[model samples]
Target: MKITEKTNEGLKREYGIVVPNEDIATKVAVKLEEIATKVSLPGFRPGKAPKDLIKKKYEEAVSSEVAEEEINKAVDQIIKEKSLKPAYRPDINVESYKFGTDLSFELSLEVIPEIEIKPFDNITLDKFVVEISDKEIDERIEFFANRQKEYKNSDSQGPVKTGDVVLIDFVGSTGGVEFKGGKGEDYDLEIGSNSFIPGFEDQLVGAKVGDIVDVNVDFPKEYHAKDLAGKPALFKVTVKAIREAVKVEINDEFAKKFGQESLESLKKMVRESISHDYEMSSKMALKKRLLDALSNEYDFEVPSKLKEMEFGAIWKQIEDAKAKGQLDEEDKDKSDEELKAEYQDIAERRVRLGILMAEIGEANQIKVEQKDLNKAIFEEASRYRGYEQQVIEQYTKNPRLIEGLKAPIFEEKVVDFIISKVKLNESKVSKEEALKKEEEANEPAKKKAAPKKKTKAKKEEE
Candidate 1:
């Protein structure tokens, strides 16, 4: 057996391998001997079959299997001896192979780039801290209270208004012919909710009870129902009743409805919820800043294969969005080439950051504990509500799915480890301010021309 380096470029290696014909024949004979022990022939008992007979009957199949095994063994040995960490599976092309000839093949692969761990102490980042305020808690309480609001028939007979729930019977038609799912009886629709077609709710805003009205609306161009998309329809509606909403008073009974002992306890719970939200948001912003800083600090050659994979995934998403008419606002005006160029850079940056973060985590011996993984699994299961146990079972049954859960846990742990070593300049900011800063940070960068520097003569003239 022999191996020779065919190509050695940035993070890429290609090798030419040769396996002697005698080695392949030896493997084939061993396989045939093993098969002869289990397989019975017409005249000979299982293990007593003649070697020539077995070779004549199974040589082709056994030789092919032996060749594959020998190739894998050779590749594995090369990888071990070379200490090569491939980014993805190596591509092997069998150049030539014959029954009585040396097998030759080409193995090509992109290896993981050698990343250098940088000192984190020199990295400075702003850690925006937001304190949960009384007003925020009050607003949250009001939100929950609003959800528990009750409605009653309006005492005054008047037209329906915003926030009023109207019960009506309607039949919708396009081109004077009614279609399936175009009729509803005793449907309760809240005015101004925008739950119906774009113009449907607005047309019903001033409709009075006992009034029969023809409401006209055009289905949106991208309506989910293909037949109705971009089509105008008329709904003949009879308003039956109008109900006005009444907010639920925050009291002991209200608190009990939510499984709390008292109003104060409910407020405390609300405050804690808000505080958790703020904390999570702050940490997310800090992580983003940390990643950006790290990406800027390190400039190394990332494996092109990994970048292509990342770019392929991102491009697929863009194409899917375009197909669904859900292209992002920022991308709407850009040409396909322009969007591709922009997202290609994003993909490269992501690959670079991912490699750097993994290196840092490895260098520092950071790990996600079993308890942390269990907690993550539990949290993921909780998202399914009543099917929590089933979700947990699904994850437990599938190791691959468990790895999906482990990836984020591992990344977050790495982020937290980096955060611990870096200098975080904590500054208290209002919740709104913190959120606004995050929004601004996430906005796509726009190119601006640099102002021309003033010469000394120009400065003197000015």
Candidate 2:
């Protein structure tokens, strides 16, 4: 057996392998001898068959199997001897193979690059400290009170007014032709709600019960129904009745309606909920600042394989959005060249940050506990509301599903670990300002989305 390097470049290796004819013959002979002992025939007893007979019947089958096993072993041995970690399975080129000829092949592969970790103490980052404000708590209380409001028939019922619910029957048409889904009976519409087409609800104001009136409205230019978008429609509306909402007294009885003991208890629950939201928002903002700082601190070329994988995932998402008719305005206008350049930059940044974060976590000996993974999974499952138990049970039964739950948790832990070692300066900002900063940071990437090539299948459905 002989092995020679064909090429050695950055993160890539190729080699030529050759097994001499002598070795092939040696292996074939051994296989033939083993088969000879076990051979049986119609005219001969078991273990009494000749070598010539075995070779004639089973030589081709045994030789092929032996060659396959030898090639696999040779490939594994070469990788082990070179201390190579392939990013993907090797591409094998079988140059030649036969019973009495030399077996030759080429193997080409990309290797996982070695990571050089930097010290954590040198990194610096900013940490946001957001205090839960009293105004926020009051706003939450007002929202809860609105949810508890009750509706009653209006006392002054001469005409329906804003904030009143009107029960009506109506048929609508555009250009004197009735459209599909344009007719309904006894529809309860809330005036001033803006739930219908623009100007539809406003025109219903000051209308008396049993009064049939024609209401005109223009459908929005971006209406989901393509046939009716930007079209003028007139509805023959008859107001049958009118009702108004009355705010419920925020006392113990109102609190008990939601399964709470008292109004004070309900208020306490709302405050806690608001506090939790603030805590989560602050933590996320702090993480972003920390990551940005770390990225600026370290300098290294990210592995191209990592960048390609990330880019592929992002491109898949873009394609899916285009399929759903949810492509953003900027995406609809982008050329292929512009989108590729933008997405390529995003891929490089993500890969570089990911590798840097992993290095920091490994150097610091950071670890994610089983409890943390389980808690994250449970929290995610709870988002499904009533199906939480079933989701939990399903994940618990599959190890791969549990791993899917743990990857993001582990990534976040690594990020947090880096944040802990960095010098973090606290800065306080208003909610609106922080949101604006986040949006500004995302603007550049948002403007470069690629206009996907529309598929015939998608167009047919549309």
Candidate 3:
């Protein structure tokens, strides 16, 4: 057996590995001998088959097994000897092979880059603190009560009000030709919900029960249905009924309807739920800002293999977005070269953050403990309400999903650890202010419009 370095570049390596025929023959003979002890041929007694006959009959099968073992062993030996850690699985392409000749292959791999993690104490991060207010709790209680509100039929119905949900049947036609999705029976539409065409519901105002009226409107240019967009149409609408929402009273009885024993209990629950949500949001926002800061502070060359893998993932998402005509308007304006550059930056940031977070976790001994994982799993399962056990089973059985869950947990633990070590300047801010900062961090900077292309970009490229 022999190994030779064919190429050595920045993190990229290529090698040639050769396993002599004698080595393969030895392995095959050994395998055949093992099989001879437990196997028989049609004309031979068990364990009595001649070695030459066994070789003749099982040489192909034995050779295949031997080749696989030899290749694996050769690669492992070479990697171990060179002290090389691949950033990804090595690509092996068989170069040449023969029954009586050496087995040779070319190995291509990207080595993991050495990471010199910066000191944690040197990293600076801010933790946003939001003070829970009673006023906020009252506002949330009101919102929760609104969800339990009911509707009652209006008796003094002279004209339909903006807040009323009107039930109506209508047919739309342009020049006496009806279109699809322009007609319905007993459709309950909230007048102010903007669920229908801009003027569709307004036209039903002053319309009484069983009143048939002709409403004319034009669909917007951006209407989802291409055929009716921007076309003027007359809808023959028949008002079936008029109804209004009946706001629920913020009383004990109303609170009891929400599974709470009393209004006081409901208010307490709402306050705690709101506080918990705000706290979680604050922590998440701070963590994201910290991650961004870390990215800004550290500029390291990520392994090419990792970058390609991450880019492949991001590119797939880009292609999916393009398929749905969901490409970012800002990105669409850029040139192909410009978009590539931007996406490459995005790929780098992802890889950088991944490496940094993983290293931080390792440095601090942060881990997803069984208890924490079980709690997370239970919380996730509780989302389904009654089928928690099923959800838990589903989560535990799928290793990939478990890893996905572990990522956020690991990132959070790392972030918390960093926060403890760093000089955190805690600044108390309103929830709105924290949210504003979060939005600003996520918002992309405005750029000049892209020049028109001679030809439309390929769907995937776009």
* Per-residue lDDT of candidate 1, residues 213-319 (tens digit): 89999989888899999999999999888977776888888999989999999998888877787788778777767777786798888888888987777677777
Ranking by lDDT: 1, 3, 2
TM-score of each: 0.87, 0.73, 0.80
Query: Which candidate's lDDT is highest?
Result: 1
After superposition on all C-alphas, the RMSD of every candidate to the true structure, in Å, is 7.7, 6.7, 6.1
CA lDDT, every model vs. true structure? 0.81, 0.74, 0.76
Deviation in angstroms for 142 in model 1? 1.5
**Runs of candidate 3 exceeding 4 Å displacement:** 167-189, 195-203, 212-241, 244-247, 440-462
Residue 196 CA displacement from its true place in model 3, Å: 6.5
Better of 1 and 3 by TM-score: 1
How many pairs of residues in model 2 come into backbone collision? 0
Steric overlap count per candidate: 0, 0, 1
| Tens-place lDDT digits, model 3, residues 297-405 | 7887788778777666666766666676777775667676776676676667777777778876776688898887888899899899889999999988998888788
**lDDT of residue 369 for candidate 2:** 87
Screening candidate 3 with a backbone cut-off below 3 angstroms (N, C-alpha, C), the clashing residue pairs are 150-246
Top-TM-score candidate index? 1
What is the TM-score ranking, best to worst? 1, 3, 2
Off by over 4 Å in 1: 169-188, 212-238, 443-462
Query: Which is the better candidate, 1 or 3, if ranked by lDDT?
Result: 1
The candidate, 1 or 2, that scores higher on lDDT is 1
- For model 2, residues 324-368, the per-residue Cα lDDT tens digits are 876656557888677667678766766667666666666678777
